[model samples]
Target: MIGKLSMGAGAVGAISYCYYDKKATDGNGEKAVRGELLYSNEVFITKLPNTHLHLQYLAAQYHQVAQLNTKTEKFIWHQTFNFPPGENVSNETMVKIACDFAREFGFEHNQYLVFRHRDKPHEHFHIIANRINANGQNTATDRKNYERIQLFCREMENKYGLQVTKSKQKSYAQSSSVQADKLRKLIDKHLPTCQTLSELSIALKKQDVIMYLGRGISFTDRNSGVTFKGSALSRHYSRSQIESRLGKSLVLQAPNSKQIAISDQSGSKNLNTVIKSKFPSQKESLPVSKMISEHNNATETRKDLAKINESLRSVKNRKVKRRIN
Candidate 1:
């Protein structure tokens, strides 16, 4: 899992983006509000529907509290917890984790909301809380925030049996040069036998190298647990570059998770359940999908190569001396 924290002045915009029912289109012509409220603290009322006004009202109240601590210009605390791919955590568990972090980090009394966003390949939840609580006090402290979070996330992972992200930090005591040498050796040994990018990942794991595919490919030495980018080894070792070498075609598939704006709204219950419960198989894998294509240039190069290879094969009757750059 990954933990991130940011602070801002606007609350309504943040709240609406996470919990709004009506669809709001973004620059990409996609829904800006692509998630549902897993749990909300003070935004709900018995009879009144959660409208734009209600969102504004909560923001206004939080801003009112922000006035008490004029020193804290950024008064809205926005926290997001990201679970790794293939870790099927439930909605209740995610909410519990966020609430646990809040109580431990000294924001228990603050008004907050948790939203589960399934618009991406991996599962993640966001927590928007008032930095200035109802009691006229600053709840969030920036001092040593990162250090505390590192430990807290580890504790939570251990407690809940979630994927431990702190392994890299813990096992990263070895020199980077040593780690890189090990990674390079492994890649050289295994690259020839693998075909698909996913195949290469599975092959590396047998040798104790944990491959993480994202915008690019990275490998973690299971012994040292130090992760190094593929580009660091060589530019050709990148995700798309490797795919090009392997002659794998790019498959642009949309996210299988349907966006839900309201928690009460009904959709395919099985799909939603699978999104939360199902995990990926050991051999088959997907890159960390915060964004689909990180190495677009390299990916484009691969497509061009594929087309060129096909064209060359078609003109095999004549000797065509084609030099590829």
Candidate 2:
């Protein structure tokens, strides 16, 4: 199940239109507000108010109930249904399931306004809830709230026999790297034909390839290997896209003199010196000679040490003989 939390503020007008039913007459003989037509795109399943304004109001009330004055009160945590089309669960059932989950997660005080938005291809619901609990206590909405919501979603899916999409847990960095790899391949394929960064930008735009520009050239897709002149790409693409694609560019100014060093005798000698210093001697026996020299030196040192020790022992033996005489 995919779940996202959104805070809705300044939507009082939208909320107020949900509860006004035009067909129903008011007590004073006034025609009831035609809220149903206004909210044709919205399906309210629970006891919560139908208007977006009322939903926001309830959310604010709950925000107070949860004592979350410092935190934003107008919020919606959206969850997608795990059930397949064959299960025949109506959009209303999904909305109710979501509302029940929200209530379980400390949204009990204010009524939850659940609306199934028909704007998208898939059936998704919008849940507006007050952030406060009953008895006017401030509710906590943090990472833990998200985890509990996920747990509840899992349980509900099992109870209703819904197909659940397993979420692959990944750090932001890992996911970003994966995305970068994908973009890099796209960039590499288009880089050669892109004579200028603008041309590259146009090519990428056609492919829906987004990139960020930085000081150093960076490619979003490894395969595309797109090169961006920081200044050129910055004007065409968004800063975020540029930064996201090409990291910061490294600017190096050309030397003023631009003196071309000719490979004359001096240059040749210098080159030879560098090569000789870096490479082994052409003579293969050079290493063997050095090894032999080292071994001889070591043998001589051992012999000298042995001779010294023998001399010391001889002197001690003579002293013992002299003392005995």
lDDT of 2 by residue, 1-325 (tens): 4455545543443344334443566676754543332112122333334322334444344344445444554443333333333344566567567656655766554445555544334545555555444544445364444346557767777776666745321111222344545555666576545434565667877776544333433333323333333233333234434433331222123344332222323335222112112233459668889999999999999999999999999999999999999
Q: State the weakest 10-residue window (summed lDDT) of model 2.
A: 269-278
Q: What is the lDDT of residue 170 in candidate 1?
A: 25
Off by over 4 Å in 1: 20-32, 42-53, 166-325
The lDDT for every candidate, in the order shown, is 0.69, 0.48
Q: What RMSD does each model have against the real structure?
A: 25.0, 17.4
Best candidate, TM-score: 1
Look at candidate 2 and tell me the lDDT of residue 18.
38
